[model samples]
Target: MSSVRRAVSAPAARLGLVRALVGGYTLVYLARRRKMLRKVVRTDPAMFAPVGPVRALRRPVPAPVADALNDATLVSTALFTLGAGHRLIGPLHSALLSWTLSYRNSWSMIFHTDNALVVHTLVLGASRAADAVSADALLARGPQPAAHPRYHWPLRLMNASTTAVYLLSGVSKVARADGWSWATGDSLRRQVAIDGVRKEVFGSHAAPTAYALYRHKALFTLFAVGSLILELGAPLSLLGRRFGRLWAVSWFGMHWGIRAIMGIKFRYQMSGVAFAAWFDVERLLELARRTR
Candidate 1:
C-alpha cells in the first residue's frame, strides 16, 4: 500500500507544469487552426456528420455562431493556461475545447490524434493542477497546500489513459485476421504505398521517402516490428521514470519516422507535449528557479 501510494504521488509543481504545457500547446494549436476552422464551418451542411459532444446538434451551426464559440473557447483556454479563476474557467475551457474539436471533426474526418490531448486536458481541468507554478499560486493570499495524493493521482490517471490509447491501437492492429503477420512488414509497406498513392491522386505531393524506400524490405520489417513493440509495450512506461522516459522518447521518434515516411503528421506527439506526463516536468520549473 505504501509503495502504491508513493508511486501515484508527486509534487504539485509537476501537475502545474503539465497544465501549462498542455494548455499552451492547445492554445497555439487552436490559434493556428482558427482560419481553417472558419472555412470548415462554411462547408456544405450536408457534410456535417456530427460526432462526440457535437452529436447533440442536428445540423451544422451558422458560421458566425461557430466563430463566436471558437473565439470564446480561445479566451477560456488562455485563462485556463494562466491558471486564473481556475475553479470556474478550468472546466469551462475543457467543455469549450471538447465542443470545438468535436464540431471540427464532424465535417469530414475524425482526427484520432487529438484524443490524447483532449483526455489530458480534461483530467487537468478537473484536478488541482493550478496549485503551484501558476498565476493562482502566485496570487494566493496565504501559504499553498502541501503536496498530496490528489495532485498525484491525476498524473497517474493521465499516464494510464495515454498508455491505454497506445494499447488499443496495438490491439486493433493485431486483432485483424492477419494478426501477428502484421509485424512481417508487408502490411506496413502496403499502407505506405497506398498513402502515397492517395496523396498523388489528391493532387498533393507524396512523401519522397516512401518512394525512395519502397524496395527496402528489411527496413520496412524493422519499422513494423518497432511500431508493434512501441504500441504494445507502452505499459512498460508505468514501471518507473527511466522506463517512462525511454518510452516517451521512443514514441516521439516513431511519430517523426511516420511523418517522414507517410507525410502524415501527428503534431502533438511530434511536439513532445503528448508525453509530458511521463517525465518530471517539475524539473523544468526547478531549472527556471535556479537560473533566476
Candidate 2:
C-alpha cells in the first residue's frame, strides 16, 4: 500500500496546473460554442437521435428543458474550471456536459476532437484536483499534503484514455481496410484526390498540399506507412514517461504532417493537451519563463 501510494504521489502544484489548463480550455470551448449549443434546442425534433446516457431520457428533450440544461452546463463548467466546490460541482459538470456533447453529436456529424477533452474533464472531476491552487484549496485553513494518489491517478487514467483513442483508431483502420494496402501510397493518393473532389463538391478549396502530394505516389506511400506506424504504436505510451514523451512527439509530428498533406487537423490531439501527462507542467512553465 505504501509503495503504491508512493508510486502515484504527484506534486499538488502539477495537478493544479493541469486542472487550470484543462478547465480553462474547456470553459473557453463551451463559451465559443454557446451559440451552436443554443441552436440544439431550436433544432427540429425529427433530426434528434439521443446518444450516450441521454438515450435514457426516452423522448425528445423539450426546448425549454434543453435551454436550461445548456445554461447549467456552462455555469458548471465555469465552476469546475475555477475549482470551486469541485467535489460536489465536478460530477454535476461532467453529467451536464456529457449530455450536451451527446446531444450535439446526435444531431450532426460527431466531432471526435472534443472527445479527448471531455474524457480529461471527467477524470479531473473524479479526482482531487482542487487540492492545490484552487478555490477549494485556498479556502482550507490547514496545511495540505504535498502529494497524493488522488492527483496522479486521474492524470494516469486520462493518459490511458487518450492513448486508447489512438490505439483504437489505428486498430479500426486496419480492421476495416485490412493489411498493408491501406498504408500504401496509392491509398493515400486516392484519399487525397477523393478529399479534393469532396471539397470541390462542397464549394470549398481543397488543401493546397493535397494537390501537390496527389501526383507523388512514392512519397504519399511513405506518409501512409508512417501514419500507420504512429497509430499502431500508440499503446507504447503506456510503458512509461519516456515512452509517453516519445509517442507525444511522434504523434504531434504525425498530425502536423497530416495537416500539411491532407489539410486535416485534429486540433485537440495535436494541441498537446491529449498528451499532457507525458511532460511536466512545471518544466514547461519554467521554460516559458526563461524565454521571456
Candidate 3:
C-alpha cells in the first residue's frame, strides 16, 4: 500500500478511494457483457441496427495489437497479484481496457492503440531481458521466441512511443474543441460538470479543492499553458541523454498533478515501459555487474 502511494504520490490514496467506484462500473459492464452474449445466443430482435445491419462476432486468433495487449495485461496482472512488480504499477494492469476503441479499428493495417502500447512495452522488456542474458555464460539460451514476437531477433527495438499519443491527445482536444478554449476556466468548469463521462469513469471531480481552483480564470489559463507545454515538449522524454530525465520527471509531476486535480488519470502516466528507447532495465542489470 505504501509503495503504491509513494510510487504514485498522493493521488494513490484518491485512486484507492475511487477504485471501487470504477470496479462497480466494471462489474455492471461485465453484467451487460453477459447480457449481450445471452442476447446474441438467443437471437434477440433488438440486436439488429436501425439500418438493418447485424453486429459482427468476436474475432478468432490474435487481432495483432489487441490480443497482444490482452496477453501482456494478463501476465502483468498475474505477476502483480502474486506480489512481484506490484509496486511499479497497481491494478492498472487489471483495469478494463476499451479494446474496441474506434480509432484502433479505423485503420486496416496498424495494430490498435491499446495493443500498440502493450506490445511496445513487452518488446521493451524482452530486449532488456535478452541483453541481461547475453552476458551470461550458461543461462544465456538460444533465440527466445516469446521475447521476440518476430521469431528471430534476440533483441527487439525499443521505440518508447507513448509520448506521441500523449501529444496527440492534447492536439486532439484542441482540434475537437476548436482550438484551446480549455485555456479558460469557464470552459474547464463546464467540461468538468459533464455528467455521464466523469461520474461513470472517475467517480467525482478530481479533488474538491482542485475543482474550486479550476473555476478560476487565471488558474485555468495556467493549466492550459502548462498542458500546451506538456504536449509540445513531450518528445523531450524520448531523449536518451540527461535531458530525458528532466523531461520525463517533469511529465511525471504534471500527470500526477492532473490526476490529483481533475480525478483524471492518464492511462499512460507511468508508462516507463513505453520509454524503452530512453532506458533499459535488463541492460542496466547486466551492466551493473560490469559484464559484457
Candidate 4:
C-alpha cells in the first residue's frame, strides 16, 4: 500500500499545471464555439434529446435561459483557468461546464471526445489543484503547501480515467463476435471508408488519404494492430512516468493519423492537453524560473 501510494505521489505544481492547461483548452474551445452554441439553443426544440446532466430537463430550456447559462459558463471557465476564486468557482465551473457541454451534445450527436475533458475538469475542480502556479497561490498569505498524497491522488485518478477510456474501447472491440479479428483491419478499413463517404455526402471533402490507402490491406492491418496495443496497453502508463509519456505521444500520433485518414478530429487529444496529467508539466514553470 505504501509503495502504491508513493508511486502515485506528485507535486502540487504538477496538478496546478494540468489544471491550467486543461482549463485553458476548454476556455478557448468554448470561445471558438460560442456562436455555434448560441445557434444550437435556437435550434428546433424537437431535436433536443437530452444527455448527461441536461437529461434532468424534460425539454429544452428557453433560448434566453440557455444563452445566459452559456455565457455564465464561459465567464466561470475563465476564472477556473486562472485559478482565481477557486474555492467557490471551481466546483461551480465544473457543473456549469458539464451542463453546457451536455446541452450542446443534446442536439444532433453526442461528441464522445469531450468526455475526458469533462471528467478531468470534475477531478481538478474537486481537488486542491490551485495550490501552485495560480492566482489563488500568488495571493496566498502563507507559504505554499508542500507536495503530498492529497495533491497526487487527483492526478492518479485523472490518469486512471484516461486509461479507462482506451481500455473500454479496446475491450469493446475484442468483446465483439469477431473478437481478436478486429486486429485484421477489416472493421477499421470499413469505418474509414464509411467516414469518407459520409463527409462527401455532407458536402465536405473526403480525406484523400483514406482513398489513397484504401487498397493497402497490409498498412491497415498494421494500424489496426497498433491501435489495439495502444488501447489495451494503456494501463502500462500507470506503471511509470517514462511509459506514461511514451504512451501519450503514441496516442497523440494515432489521433493525427486518424485525422488524416478519416478527417475526424479529437481536438483535445490532438492538442496534447488530454494527456497532460501523464507529464511533468511543472517543468514548464521550472524552465521559466531558470530563464528569469
Q: Where does candidate 2 clash, by residue pair?
A: 185-221
- Give the lowest summed-lDDT range of ten residues in model 3: 9-18
Question: In candidate 1, residue 266 scores what lDDT?
Answer: 97
User: By lDDT, who's the top model here?
Assistant: 4
Candidates in descending TM-score order? 4, 1, 2, 3
> All candidates: CA RMSD in angstroms?
1.6, 2.4, 12.9, 1.6
TM-score of each: 0.95, 0.91, 0.48, 0.96
Residue runs of model 3 more than 4 Å from their true location after superposition: 1-116, 125-129, 133-138, 141-160, 184-186, 195-206, 236-240, 271-277, 280-292
Candidate 4, superposed: residue stretches over 4 Å from native = 1-7
The stretch of ten residues in a row with the least summed lDDT in candidate 2 is: 277-286
- lDDT per residue (tens digit) for residues 209-260 in model 1: 9999999999999998998998899888888789988988998998998999
lDDT of 2 by residue, 123-227 (tens): 888878888768888888568667877778888898888888888877876787556678876766887899889988999888888877677788987887887
Tens digit per residue, CA lDDT, model 4, 152-189: 88988999999999999999999999999999999999
Residue-level error in angstroms, candidate 3, position 181? 3.9
Which of 3 and 4 is ahead in lDDT? 4
TM-score of candidate 4 versus the correct structure, residues matched by position: 0.96
Which stretches of model 1 miss by more than 4 angstroms?
1-6
